[model samples]
Target: MDEQPETVPEPAGGLDRRAELSEFLRTRRARLKPEDVGLPDFGRHRRVPGLRREELAQLAGVSVAYYTRLEQGNGRNVSAEVLDSIARALRLTDAEHAHLMHLAKPKQHKKKQAVRTQQVRGPLRQLLDMMDGFPAYVSGRRSDILAWNRMAAAVFGDWSELPPQDRNWARLVFLRPEYRDLYVEWDQKASDMVSYLRMDAGCHPDDPRLSALVGELSVKSEEFRQLWATHDVKEKGYGVKRIRHPLVGEMTLNFESFRLPDDSEQTLITYHAEPGSPSAEALRLLASWGADATRAGTGASSR
Candidate 1:
C-alpha cells in the first residue's frame, strides 16, 4: 500500500507556494550548465538553457518523474531530506536554501498585519535626529521611508522632496536614475532590495499595498520582473555598502538594519564609517553639508 504524504496548512491569503517553489527551482536550474555541474555535453545541440531535468534528478538522487512532478508543483509531502538534497544539487547559498525551506513548508505563525501609517512617532523621529553623526532612517514593512534624519537626506539624497508615493526605498532603487549612480554595486544592491521585498510579500501575501508595489515595479523595470520571478528571498540585516555620493565621492560604510522594538514591523537602517578612515572624514563632511542644507532651505549640491 502506498503511504500518503503529510499535509500542512496553507499560508496566509492562500498564497501559491507551489507556484513560487516551481519558479524558484526553474530559475536555479536555468542558471546551471552541464559543465558547471561537472556533466559532459554529448555534442548534441541543446534546445533549452541550463541543466536538463534528468541530469538534475541524477545529481539529487531522485527519480526523473518525481523531480518533474516537483518542478510542476504537483509533488506532495516533500520531506526535509529531499529538500536538502535538492538544495545541495542546486548549490544554493545559505540564504537561498532558507528561502526554499520557507516556500516548501511554511509553518503558520500568527500573521500580524503590518500597521499602516506614514507618520513616524515623535520619539522615533527624535531618536533619528539624535544620531546626527550617523545617517539613519526608518522604513515601514513595505520599504516605505517613513522618516529620516537630516544626515540621511544628505547621504542618500532628499527623499522628502519627492512625492509621497516616491518616498519608498524599493521604488527609488528601481525608478530613480540618481539612485543607480549612488551605489558602487548597483545591481547587487538592487537585487538585495527586491529580494527583501519578496521575503516580506511571502510573509504578508494579502497586503494590497505590497501587491500594488510589486505590480507597479514589475511593469516599470525589466530587471525587477526577472528578479521577482526568481523567488529569491532576503532579510534586511547588517552589511557593507560601497556608495558613490555626489558630494562626498566614493566611500565604503557598514550598514545595519534593526527592527524597532516598539514597532516590530518597522526597520531602522543606519550607516557608519570606520574610525580614522577616509570614509569617516566623508561622513563628517556630509554632516556639515546637511547642516548647511538645513540652514539654506535648499538641498546640498552633491557635486
Candidate 2:
C-alpha cells in the first residue's frame, strides 16, 4: 500500500492576520487627505474619506492594484521595503511606523504567554526617592503604578489608598474626576494616555491584563472608546504637561519619560518646573507640604 501524504497546518493567527492588516490600513488611510499628501485635487466628489487608493499608490511608488490588494487584505508576504513605503505615505510617527511593521509581520508563538509581573527593584525605588525636587514614578507596561515616590503621590494623587489592581494611570484619568480636572489640557493628555496604551497593546497583543484594562475603559468611558478607535500610537517621551493642582493652582511642568534599561517594559517618568518660575515655587510649596505631612505621618494619603 502507498503511504498517505501529510498536510502541514497553517500558522497560528493566519486567519485573522489579513483582517487586522486590512483594518489598520483603512484607518491610517482615512486620516489623510489628498491635499495633505500633495496630490492635485480635481474637485471630484468623494464617496469615502481620506486619500484615495490611486493617490496613495502614486505616492508610495507602488502599483494601484497592488496597493488596493493590500488595503483589501489580499496581499501576502508583503516586503519590508513596500511596508516602509506605505508607512511613509501614511505620515506615520516612529511608534506608528513600528506598529505598521508589526502588523505586517507578526511573530509566531505557540501560545500566548501569561502577563509579566510588574515589580520595581529596590534600587530604582531608592533612586525615585532621591529626586527630592521632582515628582517621580515607575510605571509598568500598561501604565500601572508599580512604585512611586512621595512627591509623585503628592503631585499625581496618592495611589497607596487604592487597591494594587486599581493603581493605573488609565483608571485614574478616566474614572476619577479630581484626577481628570488636575490636567489643564485634559483632552490632550487623555488622548496621549490612550495612544500610549494603544502602542503597548500592539506590542503585547496577548497580555490579558492589558485586554482587561482596555475592555474596562471601553465600557466605562466613551471618550476612551472613541480615542482607541482612532488607532493612534505614541511614546510618552519629553513633554511639557500643564497641571491644575488643587493645592498648587495652575503650573506648567516639563516631564521626561525614560524606559528603564534593566526592564524595557518599565518607564520612569519625572516632572520639573523651570527654576525661579512660579511653577517652581509651587513645587517647593508642595514639597514643604509633603515634608509636613511626613512629619505628621500623613504623607501621600492626606488628600
Candidate 3:
C-alpha cells in the first residue's frame, strides 16, 4: 500500500509554511513527465505521477535521501544553490521560482499583526480622478479594492454601493453572480484571482484576515476550492480583459498594474482601450455618462 501523505495542522490564524512548501513542490513535480525532461519512458505502469523522488534528485544532482527530506517539508537547511538546482529541474517559471523561494524561506513574524484598515492616500485618489476616461483603481493587500475612479465605477459596476468588506475582488468574483456575467472569460478571471491570492498567501501567511477570507471562500464556492487546491501563483503585471457591459455591450480593455514603490502591498491598476477602437468608443460613452449610467443599468444606489 502507498504511504499516506503527511498532514500538518494549520496554526491558529496562520498557515504552516513547511506544509505550503511541500504541497507546492509536490504539485509542481506532479505536472511533469519523464519524457518532458529527457528521461526514458519504458511505458511501464508507474506507482506515482510525474517525476519520482529519485528521478528529481538525480536531475538536481542531489541524493534521494536529501530530496526525500525536502519533499517531506524539511527545507530549513536547504541552500540557495540547491533551491536553484531544484527549481531548474522542476522547470519553474520566474513567478513560480519566486513563490518557491518565498515558501522555502518565509519571513519570520515575531508577533500577531494588528488588524488595521488599508487607507488610500489622498494624492493617489486624486491621481485616479485625474485619469479621466481610463478606468483606474487602487488595490491593497489581499486584493482589496481600496479606491476607484468614476470611470472604474462605470466600467466595473458601482463598488461604492457595496459594504466596505464586500468590495474585495475575490468576494466579487466568486460570490456575486453578476461578475460571472460581466467577464466574457470568467474562468480566466477566476483563475487570476486565485493565483493572486496564492501569491499573497506566500508573502503573508500569518495574516489572520487573509486566512479567514480563504476559509470563507473555500466554504462558500466550490470553484474557489478547486482553483485554490491547484496552488498556482502569479504576479499580475499587464493583461487584456474582455468584459460585457449591460448598457454599452462588450469591450476589450488593456490593463496595467503598477506596484507602489513606498508600499509594495498597494498597486494602482489602470485600464484603457486602443484609441479609436469600438471599445474605446464604448469607454468614451461610459465616461460621458459616468457612474450614473452604471447605477441606472444595475439599479445600484450611489455612495
Candidate 4:
C-alpha cells in the first residue's frame, strides 16, 4: 500500500458572502415607501420600513417561500427570469439591476488561455488621440486603462510610473497612496468605483480577472474593505466630480462614459469642466503640466 501525504487545507474566513448580500438586498428593499411602489399606505399601521414579503413576492412573481429561500441563500441556480422579476420588484435602476444579477450568479472559472494584457482597438485609440483638449481614456469593464490621450494621462495621473504589470486603476485607487491625493473627493470616487465595478461583475460573471481583482482590492485597501461592507451598487452614467489640486485649488468636472457596443468589454470616459468657467482655466493649466508629464512618461514628442 502506498502511503498518502497529508495536504494542508486552504483558509476559510467563515464569513458568508451570500448571506451578506441577501441581508443588504432585503434591507434596501425594506427602505422604500409604499407610495414608491404605487401601493397605498392605506392609513394602516405598518410595522416594517418597505413593502411586506408578500407584496415583494407578488411584485417579483415568485412564491413567498421561494423568495424567502432566496433571501436566506437556499437556492442553487438563480434564473435570469427570476432575477429580472426581483429587480422590477425592487424598483432597481439599470446599475442596481446589474449588481443584483452579479450577486445571484456564481462566478465561472476562467481557463488558462494564455491571457495577455488587453488594449483598446485601433479606431478607438485614434478617437481618443483626436480629442486633444479633453481628458479621454478607454477603460475596460475592470477599469483597466487600455489607452489614454495626453490630457487623460495628465488628469487621471499616469500609471506608467509603476511596474508594467501593476497598472489597474482599481488597484491603484486602493493600493497606491498617490490616488488618495489625486482626487479631492476620494471617498465619493471610491464609492462610485465600487458601485460601477459591482455592476460590471454581473455583465461578466465568468471573468476570473474581475474576481481576482476584487479579492486583491478587498485585502489590500482598508478603505476599500470598509466600503465593500455596504453592498451598494449603481450605474455610473454621468456625474459631477469636485477635484482638489495641490497646485490649483478646486475644480468641478463633469464625467461621461460611453459604452462601445462592438467591444462590450470597454468604454470611453471623458471629463469636461464647464466652458468659460474657472475650472476650464484650471483644466488648461493642468493640461500643460499633464502634457509635460505625458511627454516625459511615454517618451513622445509634444503634440
| Each model's lDDT | 0.77, 0.77, 0.84, 0.69
Error of 1 at 172 (Å): 0.8
TM-score, prediction 2: 0.87
How many angstroms is residue 18 displaced in model 4 relative to the true structure, after the best TM-score fit? 6.0
Better of 2 and 4 by TM-score: 2
Model 2 — which ten-residue stretch has the worst lDDT?
A: 1-10
Q: What lDDT score is found at residue 120 in candidate 3?
A: 72
User: What is candidate 3's lDDT per residue for 164-205, written digit by digit as tens?
Assistant: 677789998999888888899999999999999999999987
Q: Native-vs-model 2 lDDT?
A: 0.77
Give the per-residue lDDT digits (tens) of candidate 2, residues 205-250: 6556677778879999999999888878888799899988777689
Per-model TM values vs. the true structure: 0.77, 0.87, 0.92, 0.75
**How well does candidate 1 score on lDDT at residue 125?**
80
Screening candidate 3 with a backbone cut-off below 3 angstroms (N, C-alpha, C), the clashing residue pairs are none
Between 2 and 3, whose TM-score is larger?
A: 3
Error of 3 at 78 (Å): 1.0
Candidate 4 residue lDDT tens string, 126-223: 88878877888777756766677777666655544544335566776777666676678788889888876766665554446666677778888878
Which whole-number lDDT from 0 to 100 does residue 175 have in model 4? Answer: 72
